[model samples]
Target chain A: MPTIFVYVDQFKGAALSASWETMGAAKKLAGEMGANVTALVFGHNVEGIAKESFAYGADSATLCDDPTLADFRAQPYAALLAKVCADGKPDVVLGPNTTRGRDLFGMAAALLGASAVADGIGLALKDGAVHVTRPAYAGKLLSTVVAKSRRPQMITLRPRAFPKPEAGAGASGSVTKVEPAMKEDDIATKVTGYSVEEGRVNLADARIIVSGGRGVGGPDGFAPVRELAATLGGAVGASRAAVDAGWIPYANQVGQTGRTVSPDLYVACGISGAIQHQAGMRTSKLIVAINKDAEAPIFKLARYGIVGDLFKILPALSAEFKKRLGK
Target chain B: MHVVACIKQTPDTAAKVEVKDGHVTWGDAALVVNPWDEYAVEEALRLKEKHEGKATAICMGPESAKEALKTCLAMGCDEAILISDPALKGSDSTATATVLAAAIRKMGDVDIAVFGKQAIDGDTGFTAVAVAATLGWNALTFLSKIESLDPAGKTIVVERSLEEGKQLCSSKLPAAISVVKDINEPRYPSFMGIRKAAKANVPVWSAADIGVEASQVGAAGSAVTWPEIYPLPAREGSVEILEGSPEEIAAKLADGLIAEKVI
Candidate 1:
């Protein structure tokens, strides 16, 4: 039987939730192609992650636990992954479409002399080949791509695109330990330090998002928007206009230039949706617009639009949500 | 301290793209340099000025892509080159990287290569790392700040802006770096620079000139193939505009969200 390899992306010791979603996708594709899913976990002292992969749908795992692989430098990680692929010769490889995942897959593909498809939202098996459905032109078009003649067809799935598999209790799978592909002295890139933002929910992983735009008036205008977001247990987002004005950090900006977000619900306050902004959030399952201007373009994409001052509507909305959701 | 900025021509972000007859098309929309690449070019120019070195802009596309190269020149690049050939049409990121790596090799002494975080067209954001891999150089991506550069010592330090946090990394020279928008504000082309760019000659390099074989580029050489394309289903555009007091509208919206189970 053919094997599909899933790269388990982890920071420190804990695996990213998206990695399990990727595993779920791989498992579904494996069933279609008569293949087994093998998780590839690479990190320092990450044996538990390999063991945990079995609960997330992996049939077996290959683990590379080494101090040299502790930090996410592309060279060592890709080298090890390429070595594994060379030895196992899997039919396909999958990973999460994050910074490290993209970097690692691209390098590994190059090392293996293969091509990689990025940001796949859907996957299917056609003629025993993996076909990926991915967004192009910033979600304006959908394209189905395939690695027709390549071995170990490489792909990275967009976060939240696939359902996370249910983790079963007492699941077990065989684990094969692997050695480091390169030494620490051979790698040129060094990770000096990291500065993580604390307490804020990641926008990409958020189920709900509350966004503000130019109509928020000033930096302080985000107060009401944040209140509603806090009440709803969602993340805060901003339009390019608000970000360019320095009212909020670029990390919070959702647009063609910034981050693309697909949440269960997106609340737009004072945002006049531009085509660029829509490119980021059009995939949202539900959109609610609260703007003083009825003619705002955001209302067109919203499921429910309120033509009123967001400063007033947001506070009331937060209170209403608190009472209804008992938050 | 020689710097090379890679750019591509793309439809304006505001342009409406559609699919017709199994092909993606942007009707009558003016094409411009990829917005992210403008920052790459600007950073290249800044580095050139700071180190008193040469800055060159390179692109891989059709003859029309020279227009993008000219934009880089107008923004003050010392030189520009276009790697274009009929055989290179529909080149994926890996194939494009192959051709670009060959050209970079032909250039002989490029200290650093800069690219945008991702292209607006394919949105893959894979070229820089792939090129680095092909060239066996350090791939530094999502850099928000170039903290230090020492040409004499052949070392560079940068801060990468990732989803989790800011990470400080150091790499040797002969590196490929992709920058984010937070790095710097791209400048508009000055009138004199525009005039110079309008008359500037951008040399086009064919596949043979870049020393890349026909089998290593374009669709035949690409690992990923787009066998099918279709437009995304149209969104339900009918919106229910709520008319009531703030509290009433909020209550109605809460009820609707609860009914939809999206709260």
Candidate 2:
């Protein structure tokens, strides 16, 4: 039977939720193809991580454990995965669409002579080919891609796109460790150090986001947007135009080139919908647009549109929200 | 130090890429450098201006691609090269990466290679990493910030953007990378830069010159082929113009949301 390979990713010790979710999708696809699912790990202590993969519906687990690969670098990590995939030869390779996963998958796909699909929201099986849905035209539309090749087909699934499955009734599946191909110089890049934006809600986990755009006018104008976000207990985002205008920090930008979000509620204030911005947030469950020009393209995609000045509407909405919450 | 920035000429972002009979087709072409690639050119020039090195902008596409390379020359690249040939049509990401790695090798000495993380049209996210692999060089991707470059140590550190957070890594020299929008603010093309780029000579190379076989150059050589493509269906939606009173429009919109099951 054809085998499916899923990367069991780790941040500290536990498997990242997205990795398991990817495995869940892999499980479904593999089951559809009458294929068995396998999991691959390449970090410190493979024993602990291997157990989680079986619980997620993987039938087998291969550990590429090495002291050198304790930390992930593109070259060594990619090389290790490539070596394993070369030997094991799974029919389809899957990974989370995280930055690291994207980098490693692209490199590994080239080495393996495979077709790789990016930003996969869900999988579809048709005519014995794997089709994936991804956004194009800046998120104005979704494109379905089918890899026309056979064997070693690959895709990076977006995190949280598919619902996560709970641990199965049975215990962890079988585990096996394979020696990885790694060397000191093989890891051309090394983790130097790291820092993150302080005290802000991680956008991925945020349920709501209130994003500002150039229509917000200036840096001072973001006050009401932030106020609305705070009243609603949401994180704040900005359009590239706003970030480029120096009205907000680049870290707050939301669009195709910026970040992909699945917030439950996303409120856009004073933003014209650019394709890039729309691509990032198009998947949000609920979208509200407040802009002076109701003709703004953003209003076309918005579930709720307030065709008035955001400067006027935002303050009023913020006040109403606060009053409702008795703040 | 020498930097090679790979630029691609593409239809403007606004142009719809129509795939007919399994080929990507665009409307009457208004050729421009791929939007993401402009950042690659801008970042290369900035690094050159700051650290004193040559930035060579190179591209592979139709003859029109020279215009994209010219922009690189305008931005202050010391040299420009275009790899264009009729035989090179429909080269997949793998073929393109191999050909580019071969060209970089022919350039003799290269310190770093830079590219925009992904092109808007294909969004493969493969070519940069593929080039790095074929040339046996290290690669770091999705770079947002370059904290510093220490050539003396033969290593530089950069911060890569993730969906939720950031990753900082230091890598050796002679590496290749693809940068995201967060890397650096790409400067506008100045008049003088435009003039220089327009006049700069861009020698065109073919498959044989790069030691790439015709069998490995275009669709004929591509491993993964496009079997089929259909115009994406228009989003299923209709506009309800809410006018007159706020209460009336709000209530009408609420009804519409309920009708559409969007609420």
Give me the candidate number with maximum lDDT: 1
Estimated TM-score for each candidate = 0.98, 0.89
lDDT (C-alpha) at residue A100 in model 2: 71
Provide the interface RMSD of candidate 1 in angstroms, 1 decimal place.
Answer: 1.3
Model 1 regions lying over 4 Å from their true place: none
Residue A120 in candidate 2 has what lDDT?
80
Clashing pairs in 2: A138-A275, A255-A277, A256-A276, B74-B193
Candidate 2 CAPRI-style tier = acceptable
- List residue ranges in candidate 2 displaced over 4 A: A45-48, A65-67, A136-144, A167-171, A201-207, A227-234, A309-327, B16-29, B237-263
lDDT of 1: 0.92
Among all windows of 10 consecutive residues in model 1 chain B, the one with the lowest summed lDDT is B228-237
